[model samples]
Target: MSHHIVLRVVAKLLIPLILLFALYVQFHGDFGPGGGFQAGVIFAAALILYALVFGLDSARRVISPDLLRVLMASGVLLYGGVGVASLLLGGHFLDYSVLASDPVAGQHLGILLVELGVGITVTSTMLSLFYGFAGRGGDG
Candidate 1:
């Protein structure tokens, strides 16, 4: 296969595995040191690498700037929403016990939502940075 074709094929094959590993890190964070932040960076790095191998325009087409902005904002909102929910339930901010009737369930839900938020923010930020750098003629 041609060079471009080979790069595309490799990106296609590797991206999914990278995402899977990110998910694993996010889910197993409680049992280990890595968490949503790490997972998000890993996920974003994979996409950035793909862009580096391909082209900025191609990466932009796949993940639009508008979408990335939204994803980043949504992540912060999700995290804040969890805290607000906790406050509404008469608990300290991020106590997580207010998430559900059962405190443990609330904790689980809080962790999941927070992790998701972190992932979204991290991915979008990294992608946006990549776009900025690549657009400035770094990926020629």
Candidate 2:
């Protein structure tokens, strides 16, 4: 991989674009088709490309397994927290109508938060999977 200078350069150029596109998908999801799952996969793909071009060790340094674990837990907490908050606000679980004074605004906010949590969880999970499998360093 180190010898493939052209490949490396192309990857360097492409990774940021991939990441930006993932962000676009993530943010525009509520209004359009793309969303957390798609964005997460796209984000992971960029990092996977980085790992393939740079090395697993480099990718690990960029996002350690310990951090990934924390992110996984945090994402779940975020998703669940929204539900609990809505409940505490006198609405049923996941009732976004109570999330804000304006129901429409609350709906938007809830969707945004829920989607963000999903994105975080999925991205970290996928990265963890890649690290676990790729780090094995065996053909099996």
Candidate 3:
């Protein structure tokens, strides 16, 4: 890859665009077809592509495994915390209507937060899997 100048250049150019598109999918999910799962996969794909082009070690440096683990747990906590908050607000678990004074606003905010959590978890999990497979040392 170090010798593949053209490939390197192209990857550098495309990675940012890929990241931007993933963000678009994440934020626009509330109104359109894309959502947390789709955005998460897309985001992971970009990092994987970077790994493929730049090398796994480089990708690891970009995002450490420890950080990924933290992110994985944090995402779940965020999702669960939202549910708990709703419960404490005198609503059933995951009842977004009680998340805020305005039902519509609460719905919007709740969905956005839940989707964000999903996106974070999926992205980290996918990256962790990629790192595991790529880090393996064996002759096949």
lDDT of 3: 0.93
lDDT digits (tens) for residues 1-140 of candidate 1: 23788778888899889888988888888888778899999989888877777777787898998999999999999999889889998999999988899999889989989998998899999898877777788554
Candidate closer to the true structure by TM-score (higher is better), 1 or 2: 2
> After aligning candidate 2 to the native by TM-score, how far in Å is the CA of 66 from where it should be?
0.6
Model 3 per-residue lDDT tens digits across residues 1-140: 68999999999999999999999999999888999889999999999999999988889899999999999898888899999999999999999999989999999999999999999999999999888888885310
Clashing pairs in 3: none
TM-score of 2: 0.96
Lowest summed lDDT window (length 10), candidate 1: 1-10
Clashes of each: 0, 0, 0
Provide the lDDT at 59 for model 2: 89
Compute each candidate's TM-score over C-alphas. Answer: 0.88, 0.96, 0.96
Best-to-worst order by TM-score is 2, 3, 1
Of the two candidates 1 and 2, the one with more favorable lDDT, higher being better, is: 2
lDDT of 2 by residue, 1-140 (tens): 67999999999999999999999999999888999889989999999999999988888899999999999888889999999999999999999999999999999999999988899999999999998899887621
| Candidate 1: segments with Cα more than 4 A from true spot | 1-6, 138-140
Error of 1 at 15 (Å): 1.7
